[model samples]
Target: MTFRPLLALLMALSVTVTASAQSAADLGASKPRKESTLPLLPTASEADAALISAHLLTRFHYDAQPLDDAMSQKIYTLYFKLLDGEKVFFTQQDMAKFAQDKDKFGNAIWNKDLSAPFDVFNQYVLRAIDRMNYARGLLKQGFDFNTNDTYNVDRKNADWPKDQAELNDLWRKRTMNDWLRLKLAGKSDDEIRKTLDKRYAGYIDRVKQLDSEDAFQTFMTAYANSTDPHTDYLGPREAENFDIQMKLSLEGIGAVLQARDDYTQIRELVPAGPASKSGKVHVGDLVLGVGQGATGPIVDVVGWRLDDVVNLIRGKKDTTVRLEIVPADQGQDGKHEMISLVRQKVAIEEQAAKKKVIEVTDGGVTRKIGVIELPMFYSDFGARSEGDKNFKSATRDVAKLLGELKAEGVQGVVMDLRNNGGGSLYEANELTGLFIDQGPVVQVRDARGQVQVQGDDDPGMAWSGPLAVLVNRGTASASEIFSAAIQDYSRGLVIGTPTFGKGTVQTLIDLDRFASDPTTKPNYGALKMTVQEFFRINGGSTQLRGVTPDISYPNNGDEKDFGESTYDNALPWTQIAPADYKPVADMKAYLTQLDQLHDARGAKSPAWQLMLDELAQYKKLSDRTTISLNFAQRETERKQLDALQADFRARHKAIDGADSAQADADAQLDDGLNPSERSLKTELKEQADAKKAPDPQLQETAHILFDAVGLINANPKLAAEVLPYGGKQGNSASMAAVAGATPLPTQNSAGQSGGASRAPAAASSSGH
Candidate 1:
């Protein structure tokens, strides 16, 4: 079924120029009638909704439940969440009016009727405009920042305001809080006003920028999310962007951009990309203007749309593009730092698996432990599918690294999968194959409830020695699979915090291919549908309850908001029959000894103690959902936190001594700054060593591996238990797991360049 263009839907709906004259509806109650003056935004027609609804019910995995009245109400409820996540926009009465058609959503969607959703969007636009006007007026009427009012930063769970009056009061405090935050940041009153004025203006522009396509995508996603979180609709452009991200090789500057007010901010640098390698551009830098090669007139992109700015920046390889950037450290003084860059095919190789050997002393004997940091499980699928002999994939790269490590006589291996958000499913399976001789790696259950066992039967093992997998809350999806399989096989010890718990597999389907009409113009787009759930060979699923580490450290990230458990409609974890497999050895008792060793070592280490304290403070800050509007109170809190942070850095630096400056410089480089520029400021050693420092997690994992090596050596019998299954049966496979040098993009509120877009859905897959 070829999905129609959003414009078609818009045309079918009343055009703004053609809208009939009608009476104005009060902002207060009085149901929005068809004749209301509110400009109706374009939305899915009954035909559009019916086709999508059919696709969801018939083609989606898990036999996606029927679109009944209950689902309709869910879709309606989710729409509000997506539009006004903070619960600060829509009022109680507005919700009540929208609720009248709550159950009608499913039916309307089934019929391809988008009147209700469109009508609601129109009302939202009106409300937003009204609020924006109120906010602009307040910018002129500055208030006392010394007021004792506290503005809640997060209002996701708060009740909607009863009326405009209540909302005005809330916005008043909110405005004060915004102003105070800037004041505390050291901005002058005049500067603060300009910054906020631009910010608020940018917000208004964003609202106004919403077109028929935005509405269709937003509402459709909400509807799809009611069925499952992973399922989402991406517009044609968004779909292309998704492809670019997944491929991790884009023909651009190789810098991830995020919209911040009227500016496109450089969030991070893709390692090895032209911009990163040049070492001139830094993260947190803002692009104020763009110019073509050599002396092309610089186009001020300050108020340009994000996509428009992106288009201006992106060009063919070898092309020169100059950017006027605002230094990251420089507050919004509007000063520009101009830099020129030649565009290239920036491969995200930096995030790729990298190998390093660290020496750890245990029992007065130093063991050379190899560490392989696999950022994201990625693969050059195009090359692999073409049967290229030198296909680049996570598995292939790691296998090569294993050989090098073994050649180097490393006694143990630590696979650092920390912050790996996961990627190719095929790579995950193949990576697992490198460690194990053979066995089912993961179980895949489709919409029909049929389970397909995906396994690696490669007999040629790669350095099957003492192993450890380092993870954190950012580890997820394919990374979780690899770790879980390792844990199930008793192949390695998993370390770090609980993972992000994303086990479901998503397949991007081109909606235009499914269109009923073969010759439709402007193909609708693509749908990323969660088609299957991944289960461990041992019958446990790694859905919401992500693969828990065998050993853990102090977790500072907000777990409530970070993991899959945060989603309300995520698939519940479920279990199935276990695959035929035998573990190398039971490590439960061994883990106890390892944990004790870690604790004892941690207790004596000041660096470790400092990290724990820092984490505690971080968690305290993260848990806060509100801040005082009083400038003095906020300022005092900020100073205290800053003092504590400074002290921690000092202690940390003291601990590193000679390596401190280099480490600090490298840490600063993470924001995409030029290492040379930063190095000039610090008394750092060579730039090469600057990037290498004492990684607590890697250190801890190496130590644990040393202990594992000791235990295995003490019990020679356990070491002798060799792989039993193999035969070269094949398949390809699959967190903050690393973006490996290709630094995967980060997402934020203002349309980040990369990362999976979230829909309104949550829950856990049922599993062990």
Candidate 2:
């Protein structure tokens, strides 16, 4: 129901290797003394919004100068596209008013005066609401369900006249779907109409529940964003609530709340926390009834907004917020599981570094390999800077884990960086240092074109066993930087599909910090500015092109599903002059062989075929997003896709030996199948698992290392043939450092390079 495990779509943040940093100090700091980038808070400030916003514009700097007219207009379009709502969404009247009073907005947006920020923010919120209403209408009419990232293709219709046919038709269908849902749920047409009172009466009931407090609360975010991506404004109650949320300790069932249609949905339930511990309050479970204590009757709150529900749930320590939970899987008939729980703070520990040892026995030689998972590199600056010490960073924990693994005689290390969306830049630099001795790691060029190279300060390789880095479309930002460097330096094998193409950097500045803090409830906003681009040491930009085709391996990632290119306004990829570095053997010729081997295995594997089939089905459904209209048609299409997915999942489960005989018998009876099925049947796979000998990607990396070992063994002969001018100078200096930096000969418990772990479950659960 919820996926905090690895949300690649979480707000953007910078990775390591950029010179244009948020702090005044140089960008090369391995372990920063303080997190100077985020806006300092008097209280605990390492919250979601700050992290989310800072994640995006973390490396960029903000300038006071106004944007170019062209840029402003483009941003304007984007702003509307992203902000417009689908129910009670923005309407035609909203755009006309804005156009008529452009001067009013212009002054509010750009006036140098201090009052301008708050005034502009107020106006922005008002305008946003109007647009939001229209957007909601579009959603109700069955238009593309868009969010901040996935803006509807048809939303840019404000410039032209939009009638009810073109404008609200989509929203009407969505409303009809809701209407259908009510009808299916056993609500008679007469009963629903009588209960609703008017066509938009259902909307009105939700509107009153929305209220000024909630709307203003959202407005404050827009106001806070005007300054930078870190500083934020919170009303008296919200500030306290936010503080509780960040500490991972929360009262009232420890659930993240949000408005979903007419109900307040539980977004995230802290695993092992109060709600999760109870096991009664599952994610997506709705809290429609809250009682004071054990005996209080549960109140009907189906139509209540989020804040009201939260208020009802709030209580003193040990006091119960008797929650009437509607189990996620059930619709209106969802079981009411009353959970009586004490209000207590729950600490969030999910982000802590995790370590696992994979066993590989190769050629009868057994070796244990270590794998470490780090979700984010976070630092509590205020706590550490005050000399409290013991500040947490991914590098320190990983280094410690490496030492522990080395002590256990682990041979190779695979840095499982897939879905590592990135965090503290300081961790990226320090983490890079763990792998290699002091050398240039990455270069950063700012908007002004000032370039700076961030290098590794340490001079010793940390467990340099056969290193392999696992990455995919979700491995982004700092994760990308570290992986690219490892690949560039020939320090490790780059496995998995192409990474998330996010190479830009942003910086957050607190509007409140830049202005006077009003004694009478000061409001704060943050501005996230994209200022610089991160680059590889060899001058390759890790932007849209992202980390390039490294040892080709197959993954479930479809080329067009999701990536950097998914967005319309993403920056393009380009290259600069290559850095002065030793040349590594080209893997192109070997990659071809590896690709063929992988294709052979995947083609025959039913598990892989099922996944490929699912993709085909989703693609077909997505394609239907265009030209597909009407509530009935859309519902039918959705039901078909969902059914196909369910069938595919059942097929996959059957392959896993669940009702195996029955499933297999069913499959054998069917002869006319798609090309994908035929392909699977044709290629007999000896390698459904990576442990099989035919796995070429592993062979290539191993062969590269093996060849280097052979070179080291025949050093004298190599020097004689490859370099005639040798001995004390020239060619002696030309000798490659292969002997010094080869990855450790690690083995899994199975003891083979091929036996190294494949992150199938991790990849599947994390999607890409």
- lDDT values for all models: 0.66, 0.47
| Among all candidates shown, the one with the greatest TM-score | 1
Model 1 quality (TM-score): 0.77
What residue runs in model 2 are displaced by over 4 Å at the alpha carbon?
1-72, 85-97, 102-104, 111-161, 165-168, 177-347, 356-371, 403-411, 517-521, 552-596, 626-647, 659-768
- The runs of at least 3 residues in candidate 1 whose Cα sits more than 4 Å from the true structure, single-residue gaps closed, are 1-40, 43-50, 252-302, 311-345, 362-364, 388-390, 657-694, 711-718, 721-768
lDDT of 1 by residue, 1-768 (tens): 012223233222211111001111121222212122446455333246346545665556563777788888888888887777667777888788778998887766666677788888777766776777788789887888766888888786899999878899988987787777667667677876776776566456656655666667767778767777666677765666665545545577777665555566775577777788878888768788887788877777775555556667766777778889888888568577889988877666666789998888866877778899988876656554576555556766787777677666676789998888877776677678776665778888887888977776544455445678998888888889989999998877888999888778877667777666778643577766677888998998888888888898878776877777877787888899998888854667577888998999999978788778867876887788887888788778878866666676678787777466445544432221122122222323444464565567678788887776666556645444321121111111000111001112211111111111212012122111
Q: In every candidate, how many clashes are there? A: 63, 68
lDDT of 2 at 446: 68
Model 2 clash tally, residue pairs? 68
